[model samples]
Target: MSTNLFSGARKALVASIATAVLLGGVTLVTTPYAAASTTVAAVSVSAKINAFTNIDWLNGVWRTGAGFSIPATAANQAAFKAGASVRLADGQVRTISRQQIVGANMSIFLDGAKLDGNKVGAPQVVTIGSSVVTAPVTSPTTVTAHSTSINAFTNTDWLNGVWRKSPGFSIPANDANKAAFKVGASVKLADGQVRKVTQVQVVGANMSVYLDGAAVNGSVVGAPNKLSTAGTTTATPAPAPTSPTTSVIATSNLNNFTNNDWLNGMFRASAGFSIQASSANVAAFKAGALVRLADGQTRKVLRQQVVGSNMSVFLEGAAINGTSLGYPKTVSVVSTSASTPSSPALTTPPATVTPAPAPSAPDTTNGKPLLVGVNLSGAGFGPSVVPGTHGTNYTYPAESYYKKYADLGMPLVRLPFLWERIQPKLGTPLNTVELARLKQSLDFAQKHNVKVILDLHNYYRYFGKLIGSNEVPISSFAAVWKQIVQEVVNHPAVEGYGLMNEPHSTNGLWPQAALAAAQAIRTVDSKRWIYVAGDRWSSAFHWPHYNTQLISNPWMRDPKNNLVYEAHMYIDKDFSGNYFDKNEQFDPMIGVNRVKPFVDWLKQNKLRGYIGEHGIPDFSPSALVATDNLMSYLRQNCIPSTYWAAGPWWGEYALSLDVTSGKHRPQLPVLQKHAKTAHSCTSIGPL
Candidate 1:
């Protein structure tokens, strides 16, 4: 049994093997034999024709008989070039080229004409040098020959009814053709030529058939009927399907986001088997026309569809079949005058004026109410450096720490965890003890109705090897995230998955790895928001320049389109949150202006921005004022921000928001001011 070489590139190459067959030189023959005889003699010739370029012409007309022979002579080349014509077995006259016949053995067939000692009359058996020639009697005798090689055909009874043309030929595998050879049979080539098939041979686990005395190793032969304009034959290719043209209707910032923005600006609905309109109908849609929805509902456009602007009809209560407009629903223009306008009924007021009802509170659980959050640090940065300890121990805050902050009206918390603590060894399940400690903190936050953002605090490296590098495969990083997300993704308190804490690398490796991790998380939980950060510690200053590669990567986009870009901003003169010296004093408004470019970029791309970490030092009036101004700026722009931290390890640390001397840090008052405007998690509300 031969193995099948019918897969991948090798299979495609084998399927195209017939094209290569025209480039090689081979021979075919016909012989005259007795009709009653069951046995036939064969001859095999192995020789190359010198400088023969017209292999197609030779394959079509060359045949062996008693009267014809091509001689290796210069005069024959001259005669052929002058104007000589050869009559083919089918009675068609074709001009012969010198390059096709020089030094090549050939045969000629003449209708009703005799040559040499052989007579052209009926199907007869003729012997020549241990080779048998079988001729079928017709208006012109059909000449046939057999091969003498070990794998040659033992009979020639199959050459009876096969027909051939210039580019089309048919050799049905009927009983006669099958009986001619045991494992293989002779078939007519596309160029009206007969070729013999002998046996199937195995070469390196692949099956190959010998055709026309030549080894055709795994080459694919085309159907005989399809012919090329050059008089050569090839497989007929399938026609390609046409694609619809896409037109951009709008481009705008996140604040101006509308239903069309979420839909990626695709507008067209199906009508029977075709789309109702495309770019060609843009003029109609822009003229306040009626359009059909995919669900067969017709709605009138309230206003003209903006071509290069960001405007939404969804705001005008536009919907299809009671469902809100979204992606994959095609919309098309119907009529220019059709229109539907929304009107609210007015009722007579009572003698005393009653105040209108208050608007319902926005969903804060979805990260909507100006995220005032604090970074919880102990679990992720590893165990504290304590005296007389090996530093291998892992530490986490007790429930009281979470309770105190929850009581302070903080609505969101950013929780960081170490990768090594969860998975000490590659490919192993998350460590049971470490997972329990992390879950304990998460449970405390849920008790207080505070949402948590799980942060993977690995800096794009594991065990001293950069991810996506030779040392650690990017798949390994994605694998750990898959396991981690499965454990806490469904937790009610968990709001979003922060793919990584910070990535500061080059050549787009950080974004590449971030995309891999984000995709892995999406596989488990598609609805949860995922936070993706750029390289260089997700710096706000270099966001536009350094993160260009990531922002442009199509793969970096989330399938759900629920991604929030995370960036860290610091306020010192050097843009580092290290110190707050008096000499480095700068106006709070100036600091806010410095970070506006990043905010503008986020708005322009229609992407949500989250300040994952930012902070200030001390309770001085100058520092407190700076914090107040920056927080206000972020809130006004609808940007969610989390303060740098409050943890058990920080005792009197300058930037710590932790309680000290039984009083809240000064930054708490600043945070509380912004929290008052947001929906509170605690009954006490903002201080």
Candidate 2:
């Protein structure tokens, strides 16, 4: 066997990913990811033959000029040793079986018979399952035998068949944990670290990998049974998890999530929160009378507003990047040392024989606080563009539209993506065949339920006018959200980065391409949640009251809540202006009394405000009484809206109550009259 097909082969793989910044001053200096460029470690030379690409080393042993003694189980034996040389490693394959004759006084001559010691130089490693003697044959010689067969594994190693299956049982790729074994099941890995796959590469979305065993690249089988159509491994995706993480605990308290009451999840806080002002930590738990964030991860509590005793926690759905200057203002829980009277290794618990384990508060009926539901006007159902034409068919499947809003209890789904079909091939990267069909629609919006604000319709002048670009530059639109959050914000129901659509400075570029794409998405994602798009989206002449002194700069305070401020009320088109030149005294009751100057600038900037994108224009005139008098003046001015066209407009310009053809289409018996789908966090916040 002789092989050397080097049409160029170099490889070095090391993935450690660690990004926990909230640093502020201390001489900052980030931007470092370009490492992987190595490749030169395939060295296994044997005294002298270096000339390949389909190999060339015959006369050395293929017959003549010097020494040789080949026979290690010799059936198809090959060993050339004129000047004795052999090299193979990069994609290895070369079978010689035996031979050695090196320097000044060499000695070896196989078929010509002459078997003894020192011969030439000294190296060894033939190949009948890696035999020996290529250089180190300095003694007797008579190894006439050959046998080969390899494979072993209980935990792993011996076989390099890289296996992956991820679904709800999402270990290898997507499932994470439901619907057992899949694709011809029996896929057991993680044991002893196996290594013999040789080839298996299926990537992105519908996924199907499997190299030598054959499949090879592309086949999540047209994916999308759900995980919101296989996209949310928890959005903002990019090779996420940079790793400062030791004990990021909080998953299972999305603003007050209450489920079939069994009990054990914490955080119901109200009075300025306090775990004693936390440096927050609670390890990967798993004992469960109530120990969650140890795994199902997704427990957080702070869209900012907890001051005093401070409070911070993580894990329950990762990405706690910079809760305003990286959390933990002041905490110190060190007091645990008092049980030393040991005795009872085998028999002891009978104080009446009780103790079934008790201590749970069913989150006091989820006092409400974490809700991440982003579906921005492509509302309820709208990715259908056969209208004018440039191809559009993601076929509504945000994991079955968030398991029908998690079976109507509704928790979250703010997911939108259209950076011109996710970078249509311009600067080269992130097209992975439409990111594997948008990861089967973000794994069907993270397997039925809710939590995923990944919105970024990125209107870089409409992707510079469908990839023609007249001026698409805001740092190439922050490198299309730093390359789709560097390839999708590492899952947990993705709750971050909603910065671009409806942003405006208009033909002039506001706040410098919106503060340079919000400081380049907080300089490569600094702690999640960053939805800032007023200008024309939340318009009262671009709502943001001249950035009210950039909220005492802490990058506009509210970082911990991770910043959110958008306002849009097109109250029947930019808050009704002329009732025929103020004739009817501008009635709709003075256009609902001019929304108190943008609700007093969202309580003077403690802002987490949202009317995030609106619409109500399906031929206006009391369009469902102006959409029930504009959601009863935004629930009596506490303000929270998200309606805009689902097409033939029932988004009433505020958009889709679910009626594409008439009689107010369908899903909105106007939110079943006086809207408020199940329980309440007082109207979605913290996620």
What is the per-residue lDDT of model 1 for residues 440-525, given as tens digits with 9 covering 90 to 100?
87898777776788888776667656788776888988999899889987788778888876677645677777778888987898
- Candidate 2's displacement at residue 352, Å, is 13
What lDDT, from 0 to 1, does candidate 1 have? 0.48
In candidate 2, where is summed lDDT lowest over 10 consecutive residues? Answer: 1-10
Task: Please provide, for model 2 over 1-687, each residue's C-alpha lDDT reduced to its tens digit, 9 standing for 90 to 100.
Answer: 000111001000111111111111111112222322222222232222111111111322222333332211111111232222333222233333233311111123333332222222122222223232222112222221111111110111111221222211111222221122122223322221111222111111112222124331112321111111111011111232444333322321222222232111122221011121212222212212122222222222222222222222322222222232122221111211332222232133322211222422112112232321224333222222311122333333435445654554344445556665666544557667656655565566566534555666543245334212345656676667777776666654555566665543354354455455666666666666666655443454335454443344456554454566655444433242111111111122222334445556766655665555443332232333334444445544444444432322221222343332233232243433333322323332322
Each model's lDDT: 0.48, 0.34
Positional deviation of residue 484's Cα in model 2 after best superposition, in angstroms: 34
Off by over 4 Å in 2: 1-207, 213-371, 376-403, 408-410, 413-501, 507-563, 566-687
Q: Over all chains combined, what TM-score does candidate 2 have? A: 0.23
